[model samples]
Target: MRVAVYYPWVYLRSGIERALIEIKRRSRHEIRIYTNHFDPRGTFPELDGMGVTELSRVSVERTYSAVTAAALSIVRTRLDPAEHDAVLVCCDGLGPLLTFANRRKPVVNLCFTPLRATYDEVYRDRLLARGGPARPVKRAAETVFRLVDRMAWRNFDEVICIADTVRRRVADNRLFPESKIHLAYPGVEPRLAVPEGASEPMFLLPGRIMWTKNIELAIDGFRRFLRDAPPALQRFRLHIAGMVDAKSRPYFAQLQELAGGDERIVFETVVSDERMRALYTQAWAVLAPAFNEDFGLTPVEAMAHGRPVLACNRGGLRETVLDGVTGLLVEPEPAAFAAGLRRIAQDADLARQLGAQGPARAAAFTWPRFVQTIDAVLDGAQRRSV
Candidate 1:
């Protein structure tokens, strides 16, 4: 099958890029891609190593204008005249344009969640929870995205959600027949080895430093966990890794000041994949306490390295981490996180058992499985089109 995956933008450093690479690797289908972001500066290093045929390379003008222009271009040039077997809208933002452009082809939405619900579940409260005077602007942006999201959902022939929890939201939107929608979770690239015999207790946090990531909560929990631990056991280190979003610079500064030259905490921003693998390998556990994490990549990647994760009990994290098995799941509160940390810290055997189970679990979600599912979906859709 020849499929076109259409997306509004591209960020080379993200999980989406990894998923694309994996799909490209595993699929027998001919895969072509379309994107609105074209950086002549060679910004997307990941794209350098891939074999993707680009349909158009125009830059987006502004928020509303970009969507309009992208939509127009898709309708005009991207899809060959009845050429694609299927069109996979990579995210909610591209759905409107793809649906309008390729009415002759089946359009499948590969989404993490319903965009409208995502705004309500995570972003809305997150802004108000942390935004202070910027709350009104945040709320208005949510409203705009909500309307755009709903329109996009209604237009797609099928929508693929990453978590079971998101299935309810897709159903509520009445987007497609129940059978047409699929719950296709993301998978991690397999790691060949796990680091052994760590002398010191080390914990890792990976992802952007945005308010939604709730790194502040993770930091607070770390502080509280030490307070409740014995002095000898409180010498553990927390490695916070990932690029800091510009919007989060102030918050990051504040967090650094709070750490105040404490030897127990280290902050690393924008590290390479090799460095990330090292962090996961050496760490005692990975922590992600964010709410509605929407198919968290870090936890699964950590699990792939045979490292136990201590994560929030809700959202996509719930689906990724098998509670009491792969890792301990706790509520998002600081005390709960503190307790989870302490539990894993005290039990080396239990941690080892969980860590050992991780690779097997992650193996089931290989890139081949992901692409096979999509190929089957697209094949069926093409048959229907004929």
Candidate 2:
């Protein structure tokens, strides 16, 4: 099937980009993508080779900020069923537009938590969350955006979230019935996540330094874990690696104060993917304590490398990480995370066992499986269009 997938914008080689690459690789269907901006060097280099059309000439800053690009993409990347057999609206800020532009027809929504900034109530509380200094202005903008989103959401014939937890959230939205929403789990490229020999006692927290990511929890938990841990477990260290810039520096400093100059707690401001893989390969376990995460990719990616993960039990982590199997799940609190830290640190056998089971569990969430689910969905949509 020939599908015109709407991505709207690309800023980084994030989970969505990775999913798109995997889909492009595994699917037999012809996919001509639409986006406002495309920078292969900054984002996925593979995107340069893909059948992607640059929808608009947007500035670099505007491309990264969804508040700036949302209206532009909505007004510009408007899709019609006549242009393609089916449409897959899988990108940020593009969902409302694609569904709105499709003339109330069947449009597929591959959601990653329903536009957190626009829909999330907590977003309006802070400036960094909104990406600017205009609170009242942004709220007014989101009010209009919400109206458009609701209208667009009603047009979606089918909706797919990356996990069952997210599927439930989308189902509860009331715009679409539960039956219309489905679960199409995201997968990791395990080959790139090549595991090393027996790992050292190191806990790696890999993600953005945003408040939502809760990097402070990792530092606090690790500090508490070491206060009463066995001598053998003392070798364990916590390494935080991801994009850290001027915006993140303040949050990063807060985490530093929480660490209290502990050598065990580490943060790398300029860590590359290769460095992250190295950390993944050598680490005892991956830690993701993000509260209410939609579908965490870090835990799955860590599991793909045969590394055990100690993640929060909330949100998609519950589905992605098989508790007491691939890894241990804990509540999103300091004590729970500290307890998990202690358990993984002290019990080498249990850690190894969890690590051994991780790859097999992660294998089920492969790119082929993800692509197959979407293919079936899009194929059905195409048939319905006919």
Candidate 3:
């Protein structure tokens, strides 16, 4: 089969690249990616090591322009009546897919979420209240998305959601055949062996310190957890590793102020992947309290390290974190999160058991499995066209 995968955003770019690489290596299919956005400055070439072929490189000085160009190209090419075995669009925001609704090729859309609901439920207010043209722009953008989403869903041959929660939401929308919708989780690299002496009570939370991450809640929980923790456990530390952009400066300042007079909370921004991996290895668990993550990669990385993850029970977190088995999932409330933290702190054996289960569970989500899952869908699409 010949597969063309379109990725409009840089973030989703890596995941598509990984799956393509796996398909190229293991599946008897020719896979190529088409993109007008080249982040030569970014680490996108990192996927080259994994073996995905880049069919075309489109350069753009700005993010939005690149996305628009990509979408337009999809409609022009895919709708030209020139058929392909399969066409995979990485996310719902790609508008060009709607234009190609009646194309002869099989269209597989990776539906991460309904864009309008994503803004209304997760990001709009918090971002809007922050005061910027960004908020209103998002509002207008979401309105446009509602129309795009409906067309993309009805037009595509199949819609793939990353989690069951997202699938259920789309199912309720009832725009397409239920049989055409599929659940396809993100793939992660295989787990590494747990490092010796990894049972120490350190916590790793990596991701940008943005409002969506709910970093405020994590900080509050950690501070309160320390307040009543036993003397020995007081030494336990949290190392937050990630970038702190100018937009997040105010929130970052508040986090720093909250940790005042407490030396256990360490904030390191723009850390390297190796440094981030080291933090994951040394920690007893990874803390990801994000409120509206579509699908988080941090907790998966933690699982890859054979470390347990403590995340809020919402969005993709619930799908990723196996409560009582892989890691503890708590509500968004600080007290609830703090209690879970304390529970693991006091029960070393239980923490260890959960920690040990993580790597094995992480094993089932390798790049190979992700590629295979996608290949099966593409093959089925090809057969039906016959």
Candidate 4:
């Protein structure tokens, strides 16, 4: 099958890229990716040879760039199943909006979610609350985007949500029947190498420094954990590492203030991949306190490296981290998170037990499985069209 893929951005590493790479390698399909921008050096260089076309006409900026591009992309490009047998949208946002090119072809959307700006109530409210006249203006703009997104989604032949949480969201729309939606849980590359010796009890939380990440809650829980921890655990450190931007600086500052000169609470704004693996190897467990992540990759990465993950018992985390087995899941509340942290700090044997199971659990989620799931959806979509 000849597949035309549409990914909205080529900025960062995520589960989408991992899945796409496997799709290209394993699927018996010719592929071409359409997008507004793609930097081979910045993203994976392998994408350059994958027939990615950057629509220079679609300008990418900080805000409204993706929604704008999505609308423009469908208007500019013309697609036919004769030219391309399937349309694969491997994007979280905007790409679903490109289904306007469906034209009776099988449109299989690798939907992580609808455009988050339009669909995510919390993200929309937080992002638009600037004050007075500007707030209303932002709200109006988002409303238009949401309308466009809902309209475009109607054209999708199939929507594959990467998690059950996302699948449920699509089901709630009822705009499309549940039959068109599916769960294609993303998988990870396995790398199990348990550390040689017991390192200090360190908790690693990694993601973009955004309010959406709920980094503050992680910090709050870490502070609480430190207060009552034993002398040995007192030396334990909480490492917060990820990319940061100007808009996120204020939140980073608030986290620093929350720390209150606690030397054990370390903030690493950026780290090389080598450093990240090193941290994961030596850390006690990956801390994922994101309030309700659609699907988090940090915990998976931690587990792939044979370390346990302590995450909130919400969203996709619950699906991956089996409570009291592979990892412990706690409520989003700081007290609950702190208690979970404290449990691990005090119980070294429990930590080791969880860590020991991490690799095998992560192994079950393989790239082959991810690709096969997606291929099955594509086959179904094609068969339905016939």
Candidate 5:
């Protein structure tokens, strides 16, 4: 089957782009990507050969004006039904708008979470806390977007979420029926076995450097950990590494400012896959402080590297990181994370135990399994259309 996968933007080596790359490489169907913006230099190099088509020239900006323009472009753009048997939307933001013009073909949504601003109360609260003249305007716009977003959901034959957390969000929001929503966990590449050596007294925070990551929480927690930790753990470092996009540069800068001349807090941007693996291999444990992430790939990736994960007890992290088992899951607060970090740092045996169980658990999520689940969903959609 020929499949056209639509995502709003393909300009970051984040989980969504990585998932698309894995699907294109592993799926049996002929897959082609469609997006509003495609930047070869910024995203995964593998995408260069994936036959990605840009529907319109849209700059990668997170401002309201830019998002509105991109949504309009997607709604107006049409895909020829003859070119593909079905459509798969890599729904993150406005990508579902593509279904407006391509309803002629069966549409399946691989939802990363129904737009966070509209569906996520935590995220909405944060935005509202930054009270401004635009608050009323933002609320009015969201009301309309929510209506349009739910309307677009009517076109999706099935919704495949990355986690049960997201499945519940979609169902609770009434964006799609709970019965039609399926969960397919994303896969992480297995890292080559690194010899068991003493890990550095370092905690790694890895993923796209975005505001929603709540990286400041990690920084604050690390600082708190350092103040009360044993002298031996005082030498511990916090490394923030990941892709930095245009819009997120400000947020990244804020994080740097939050670090405040502390050489212990290092920042590495747009790191190569090889470097990321090295960071994971050297770290004592990985940190995930993102606010209700759809389905965190960093934790699974860390587990694959036999590195324990210290993640917030929210969203998809709960599904992946088992507290006191695979890794510790604490509140998304600096004090809570500081306590969790202290425990992992002080008890080497506990850390080792958690890391030991990681590989086996990570092995359950495979690229082939993810693609096969998607393949079955696509086939089922096609059958219903027939």
Candidate 6:
């Protein structure tokens, strides 16, 4: 069957883009992507040859006007029902608005999470705390958006959540009944066997560089770790690697400032897949500091490389990382992470023990498995429609 997948932006090497690439490569069905923005040079090179259509010229700006414009365009756009057997929406934002115009086919939504600005109380509180004079305006907009978002969700035949964290958020919002929602975890690629050797004294933080990533916590924690760690551990370095988009340049700059010209804290932006894999293999551990991530791919990727993870003990990380087993799960504060780093660094045997169990734990999540689940969901939706 032919499926049209709608996503708002395809400009970053994000988990959503990775999922799209894997689905297209592994699924039996023909998958064509429809998006408001597409930047081949900025995202995965694998997307170059895939079937992708740009719905409109939309800038990836976070300003209210730009966001509102994109939302209007998405809701107004329509797809030809004759061209596709089903519609699959990859939604974290206004991408769900596609349901407003395309309900003729079997519509399935692959939700990462409900919009954090509206549905996530913690995130909404953070926004309001920093909202200044526009707090009232922001609150009003959120109320209106929640109504529209719920309406869009009602049009979908089914909603596939990437993690139970996301499933809970959707269910708690009353956007969809339990029967319409399903859970399908995303997958990671298997890494080649690394020759047994001492890992480099490095902690790698990998993902898109955005405010939501909470990168400052990692940087601050690393600094605190270095201040009192042993001489051998003091030599350890922290590397931050990921895609940096136009909207997140300011956040990236802020992170650089927080690093304060420290040589041990390095920033590498828009790294290649090969380089990313190499980083994972060489590092002593991986860092995941995001607050309540929908379902983090970094921790799983780290585990696939036989590397331990130092992650915030919240959200999907709780599901993926078993504290004191596969990796150390700690509070999001700098002090907590600093202590975690010291513990891993001081005990070589402990680190090795954690890393040894990683590959086996990671083997359960594979691209083939993820694609099979998606294909089955699409097929089921189509059969019900007929």
Clash count of each predicted structure: 0, 0, 1, 0, 0, 0
Candidate 2 accuracy as TM-score = 0.87
Q: In model 6, where do residues sit more than 4 Å from their true spots? A: 191-197
Cα lDDT of candidate 1 equals 0.72
Show the colliding residue pairs in model 3: 36-58
Candidate 2 lDDT tens digits, 94-120: 455656556534568888777666544
Q: CA lDDT of each candidate?
A: 0.72, 0.75, 0.68, 0.74, 0.88, 0.88
| Local accuracy of candidate 1 as per-residue lDDT tens digits, 1-386 | 78887665564355666676666677778877666663422334666566455666555443446655665665465477466678887764444555655667787887755554234355545646766876776667656756655665676766677667666656755545566678777776555334344524998998777666778778888888888998766868899998765456888898798777778889998687788878888888999888767678888887888889999988778888999889989999999999998888888898888888888777756666787887777777777778
Better of 1 and 3 by lDDT: 1
Which segments of candidate 2 are over 4 A away from where they belong? 58-69, 79-83, 91-94, 102-106, 118-142, 190-196, 245-249, 269-274
- How do all models score by TM-score? 0.86, 0.87, 0.81, 0.87, 0.97, 0.97
Worst 10 residues of 6 by lDDT: 189-198
Model 1, residue 22: displacement in angstroms? 1.0
- Cα lDDT of candidate 4 equals 0.74
Model 3 / residue 241 / CA error / Å = 2.0
lDDT of 5: 0.88
User: In terms of lDDT, which candidate is stronger, 2 or 5?
Assistant: 5
Q: Which regions in candidate 3 have their CA more than 4 angstroms from the true location?
A: 11-27, 48-84, 95-104, 116-120, 124-141, 191-197, 243-262, 271-273
RMSD of 1: 3.3
Rank order (by TM-score, best first): 6, 5, 4, 2, 1, 3
Residue-by-residue lDDT tens digits, candidate 3, 1-386: 77766654343223344444455566667756555443433433455454333323443322456655655654554323353467776664553354354356777776666552333355546655664866666567666656665766676766677767667666766655666677767656654534334556787788777667888788889888998998988978888888765456888898888778577888998666677777887888889998767777677777778788899998888877899998999999999989988988888888888888887777755666666677787788778878
Q: For residues 84-170, what per-residue lDDT tens digits would candidate 6 score against the true structure?
A: 999999988787899999999999999988798998777778778889999999988988998899899989998899998888889
Candidate 5 structure quality by residue, lDDT tens digits, 308-339: 89999998899988888889999999999999
Question: Candidate 4: lDDT of 71?
Answer: 63
